[model samples]
Structure formats: C-alpha cells, structure tokens
Target: MPVVTVASLKGIYPPIATPFADDGTLDDNKMISNIKRWSSATRLSGIVCQGSNGEYVLLSTDERVHQVKIVREHMPAQWQLIVGTEAGSTAATIDMTKRVAAVGADAALVLTPSCYKSRMSDEAIISHYTSIADASPIPVILYNMPANTGVDLSVAAICHLARHKNIIGLKDSSGNVVKMATVRKKTDKNEFSLLAGSAGFLLPALSIGAVGGVCALANIAPQLCCDIQEAFDTGDFHTAMAHQHRAVEINTAVTSQFGVPGLKYAMDMLGLHGGPCRAPLVRLTDDEKRKLDAILRDSQVQHTERIHDR
Candidate 1:
C-alpha cells in the first residue's frame, strides 16, 4: 500500500457503521448501499471501515479485512479508505495492518493495546506505536478512544509518535480540547494531521488547529458535518457555530449516550439501511427509540417523518 498523504486525511470521514443481517452475518448488500449513498450524498474525505463506529472490536481479523476489501471495491476512487487494524499485540497489529493494506486500505487506524491497560506506560505506548509504524506497510494513524479502550494516548506520547515518518496522524476522541491544543502546537501541521474523533467537539478542535475529523455523526449527517468544516474554512464562524450546536445533541445521542445501535436506528429512520447490530449489542428499545426520535427532531435530522408525525 502507498503512504497516505496528510492532505488525504483532511475533512470529514465517517467511521461507517457495519450492517448485519438478522442472522448475524455481514450484509454485503446493505453495506454497499450505505457506502454508495454516503459517497453520493456528501463530500466526505473518505470512508473508515472497522473503526469504533463500525464495531471493529467485535469483528474477527478476517472479517475486518473482508469488510475493508468490500468497501474499497465499491467506494469512489478519489475517496481514501482507512481501516482500523488494532490488535492486542504489536505483531498481530502489524500482521492485520498488512492484510488490510493488501485489501486496499489507504491507511491503518491502530488503537492502543488496552487489554493490559495498567502496563501501558508512556514509554510502552511510544514503543508500541513506533514498532507498528516502523513495520506497517501503510501509513499509521494512532487511535485514542479511552472510553472504549480505557487507554488514553497522552499529548506527550502523541507528539512523540507524530515525529515518526510512518505515524502520520491521530484520531483524538478524548474530547479534551486542551490536550488537542497541546498536541497541535507540538507537531508539524504539514506532517501530522490532527483529527477530532467525534463531531461533538469538531468545531472547537478545528478552531484550535485540527485539520479534520473522523466523526460518527457523519454516518447519519455527512452534509451537516462537512458544512461545519466548510463554514469554518470560509471564515463563517457564525454558521459553523450554528451547525456545531445542532450537531451536539444528535452527536451525543448517537455516540457517547446511545452508541452504535442508536446510530444504526437513526440511519434506518433516515431511509438508509441500518439493520440489526450484531448480537450482544441489542437494538434500541422502544422507549429509547422515542427519545432518539426527539433528539433527531431537535437536531433537524431527516427521519421517516416529522417528530410530530410520530
């Protein structure tokens, strides 16, 4: 795989949700449809398969690679496909990174090995990233999702990783603006792309110096997410703030508050195929669905009908 330029990492890229059949099998057709719809509907930087939103943790290694391959085959040529290939061990992470790269992912989003969270010292974290970046065939983007992985890559550790030629960027989901600012100040803007991991704080992240975002909200509202960045780029802070404000409730609803199932349900309501979440991850309850409907309405998201219609 070729190295992904920092330019390719800019703008809004949705960590797309994985569609599964009622029987718990990957629904290739639904996945393809969702990708096609997203590509045509908005100007996204690209699609991220097998990321946190895609339920990467729940997938087997082969399934992860296969999902990326399928997405790559169907996605627009201009769009860069980034695949999450994190594993418990450096060797395993490297191996999976190679496999995904072979299947056509433009870059790899490697999460910290958090099963041994207590032992992941700053030195251990730096060593882990350096080793993977050194060996990964594709450019590596560090993933910091402390909520899920229980491992937060500190600003110092991130800056250290940014110096590596192969470690190109970071997806900071910590929602810590001060930390993001510190990392931005330390790294070279030309070499290390800083991406907000969630839409909740994308506007603030960009205000500080983040180049773009890998937002879950982009899955249901790509245009809105992109509009926020577009507005900021054009010196339209007023418009950007409005969009950012609207995104907050929905972003929280679909992400930190509701999780993937909520996002899938939102997609379904909006006329996209957001089928069942894989087992062990249940569908939104009727009560939760009602609340999600209200959030979507308040956020002005397009759903099956008006909230009043319900």
Candidate 2:
C-alpha cells in the first residue's frame, strides 16, 4: 500500500518556483525565507517541489536533490512534501526517488518521459510509471503536464497506472475538466486522486470529484487559492465562484499567458522571492511588467500582508 491514500491527499499545493540569484545559482536562504511566509497561508495543505513551476528542467541532478533536502528542513512538518523526481529515463527517476524519500519527502511526483515523444505510447507510459512505482521507496504521483512535456497521458494510461498501489494519484494540467471527469468515472476514487494541475479550473475540477489543485496561482495567492476549496466544501458557491473568477485571470497571467517569468515578476511585486529564471527563459520586458501590474491591481491582489522575521 502507498504511504498515504489519495483520500488524504487533497488540498492546495504550490509547485514552488526554484529561486535563482542573478548569477543563476540556487539561493537556498531566499527560498527558505519564502517557504516560511507560505507557512502562514490559510488552509495551505502542502508544498510541491520541482514541478514545471519549480524549473526542474533547468537544474542539475545534484541541485534537484539538494533543493528537496533544503525545503523539507525549512517548511512546516505538517505540510506534506511532494518532490518531483522526473527524469527522462526510468532508472534515473527511480534513483532520484529513493534519494528524495531518504531525505523526508511524503511522495514522488513523476512527470511523463517525453524526450522520446513519438514512442511514449500508452503501454510505454504504463510501464514507465509501474516500474518506477515498484522501485520507489515512497509512493508516486503521476504528473500529466502536457503543456511542457507535449505528451498527455490518456485516460486508458491513467486507469492502468491507477491500479498500482504505489501509484497514488495524478496532477492533470491539461485544463480539460471533461477529460478529468472521464478519468474519475473510470477509476475508483478510493484508489486514485485527480488533482487540478492549475488553479484556473480548480473549482470545476472539484465539482467533478477532483480532490484539490497543485496550482501555480497558489504560489502568488495562497490564501485566495485555499479560499476557493474552503468555500466550495462548505456549500458556499457564491464565494467560491468569486475566488475562481479572480483565479482565472491570475492563473492565466502566471501560467499560460506569461509563463514563469511573469510568475516570478508577480512574486517580486507582491514581496515574495520570485527572482530570475534560469537561462533559456528570459525575464519580462518593462511593458509586459506594466500590463501584469495593471492586471494584478484590477483583480485587487495589489499587496500581500508581507511577512518577515525581526
């Protein structure tokens, strides 16, 4: 059996963005500071490390493992730590999973292996996840980030993977609630968790039996994201829709609209440590930043409480 069942794995988790200094180096101290503030967000369930938002592709193997160790040490114990140990090869992923589990991660978030996109068949994906789940010391969460990987895990693939006791859940970022519902219908809820990959569809995802979200918007608006889930659970659709409406634009701005650069900029504006992105990804221009600022102001996410230790 998995360490924790999907039933217990529901809530808003931020796919933490890896903080890099101007020199393109990991700033562990800065990241630790950010995690401390996130600890104060209302109803925040856990922290997700090294998903797309974490810039997992840009870091070295050593850096990925090292950051997981750093986050687990600093974040609150109550928060579950789900580390993304995704690698193109199954052997590499399995090796990384064990390393993270040794450090204190609650679960491993494994993305689809898309380097060989053409050959990533349903059978291939099923084999990859099953093999990793069998070998991993901790339970595994299948990550279906089609935007980044260009390979969406089919419902058939998900249903097959869900049967593995160690393969606990999925984070579907395709934003297709219909597809999400189909997966929910085919799989046993007790055995599988369907998490909204982004906050854009978190409510709709939940409406169709999703547990929660691993949202990029949660990185900027933790309380806002958490409120959506909290409101919906309590039968307050009006407030939930209010949060969801705000989430739609903010999520689009950070995720599909501007990608990581815009997300980091928004963090910097709101007193968070969303500094530079690693090379191959550039920062936003002055005009783009102005537009983002306007959007934020319009949505009333103008400022945060701004936490700091004396």
Candidate 3:
C-alpha cells in the first residue's frame, strides 16, 4: 500500500469521544450517527478512533477493531480514519497497529512507550517508534501526551524521527507552547507536520506554525473546531483567538476538571449522544453536572437550554 503523509492528515481532525450505550457499552448505532453528524459539520481531514479521550485503554482489542470497522463503514469516503494503536509494550502495539492497518485505517497514532517511565530514554523511544514505523503497513504519527505517558519526546528526538520516511508527524499534547514552537522551528517545514493535541492551544500552536490539530474539543463541537481552523486559514486572527479561548474553557471543564463523564454530558447537551462512560470511568456527580452546566453556558455551549433533551 502507498504510504500516507503527515500533510495528507492535516486539518482539524477530532480524536472523537466514543459514545456508549446506557448499559455502558460501545454504542455502535450512536457512534455511527455521531460520526456521520460530525463529518457533515466540519471540514475534518479525518476522524481518530480509540484515542486517549476515546478511553482506548479501557477497551478490549476486539472492540477497538470493531469500532474502527464501524466508523469506516459509516463515515463518508472522503474522510480518513486514523486508529490509535498505543499499547504498553512494543509487541502488542505493533500487533494492534498491523491489525488496524489491515482493516484499512489510514494511519496509526502510536503513543510513546511509557510503562517503565524510568527506562524510556530518547534512544528507547526512537527505537520503539522506528521499529513500528518500519514494520507497519501504514504511516505512523507519534502521539506525545506526556501528561498521560509520563514521557515526552523532545524537539530533537522528534526532529530526528520526523526525518524518517514513515514517521510523518507528532501530536504534541504537552500544552507547552514553547516546546511546540521549538519543534516547529527545528523540523523541516516541508516534510514534517506538528499537530496541537488540545483545541485549547490550537491558535497559539498554529500562530507558531502548527499545521493542524487532533483536538479533544472537536468531540463535542466539531463545527466550532473547524471554524477556528478556517478562521486561521482565512487570516481571520480575531475570530481564531475568540474561538481558541472558547475551546480552552470547554477543555478545562471536560478534560482538566470534569473528566470523561463531563465530556459525555456536554455531548448529550449539544445534540450528540454521549451515553454513560464505561465502568471504572463513572458518571459525573450531579454537583459536577451543575458546575459543567455553568461552564458550558458561560462558554455559550448551552445557549439552547437543552442540556439533556438531545
């Protein structure tokens, strides 16, 4: 198969939240409906399945594969579907990535090796990713979410990996704007792409030359996310900054403060189905919901007064 490039994966692609059934299972129908809805709402280059916000670690391997199949079957053909193949071990990650590639996913977003944080050096990360990128059928995007991984791929390490023919881009979720800028300055402008992992920092990252984003904010507000990118693309700086601020507020509520359940609740409020999150990932408290409502309203996400109707 021909390799897909980082530039090919550019734009505001949502690492979409996986919707669930009331029984707390992967809701295939709801997911299908949501994917179709989001695809229609924005100019997303693709959708990323089983990403961190998707609670991928909570899913079984079979279920992950199944979800990818469902998204591909229902999503528009023009939209590329990227799969998160991050695992605790190289063997498992590679096995899962190959299986995902076999299922026709456009690319695999591989997280940095993180189980034994003390042992994960730059060489270790490079070797782990290089091995996978070399062996996998599809191209690889380095997923750098240090907040979760406890390990970060530095600018030098990323620039080295970016030079590889198969390691196309890195999703920097570190929230370190300076590191983002450094990476942008160090990497070859034409060959490698840098994507902001959080919508909260999309404009700042973009202002420094990020090509796109794999934003969590896009899960609940796809059109708004696209609008931010569109505004920047059209040189509408004022609109972009305003949208970015809104994105930061929403992200704080759903991610930094409210967690997965809050994101699901926000989704439910916004006309999308964000059913109960799976076990071990409990529902948001009523008090928390009340707080989320205030935040959403403040962000204008709850302007319609239908927080639960949808």
lDDT of 2 at 26: 98
What are the lDDT figures for the candidates, one per model? 0.89, 0.89, 0.83
Residue 244 miss distance in model 2 (angstroms): 0.4
Assess the local accuracy of residue 214 in candidate 3 as a C-alpha lDDT between 0 and 100. 90
Each prediction's RMSD to truth:
2.9, 2.1, 2.6
lDDT of 2 by residue, 133-215 (tens): 99998889999988888999999999989999998899999999999999999999999998999999999999999999999
- Whole-model lDDT for model 3 versus the true structure? 0.83
Write model 3 residue lDDT over 1-310, tens digit each, in one string: 2245865767888887888776667889999888867766666778888888898998989989888888888887877778899978888899999988887688899988888999998899889988898888888899998888899887778988989988888888998989989988888867888889988888888899888899877887766777788999999999998878777888878877887888888888888888788778888889998988888888875552232223
Error of 3 at 80 (Å): 1.5
TM-score of each: 0.96, 0.96, 0.94
Candidate structures ordered by lDDT, highest first: 2, 1, 3
What stretches of model 2 exceed 4 Å from their correct place?
A: 1-3, 304-310
- Model 2 TM-score? 0.96
Instruction: After superposing candidate 3 on the true structure, give the runs of residues whose Cα lies further than 4 Å from its correct spot.
Output: 1-3, 302-310
Residue 98 of candidate 3: its Cα lDDT? 91
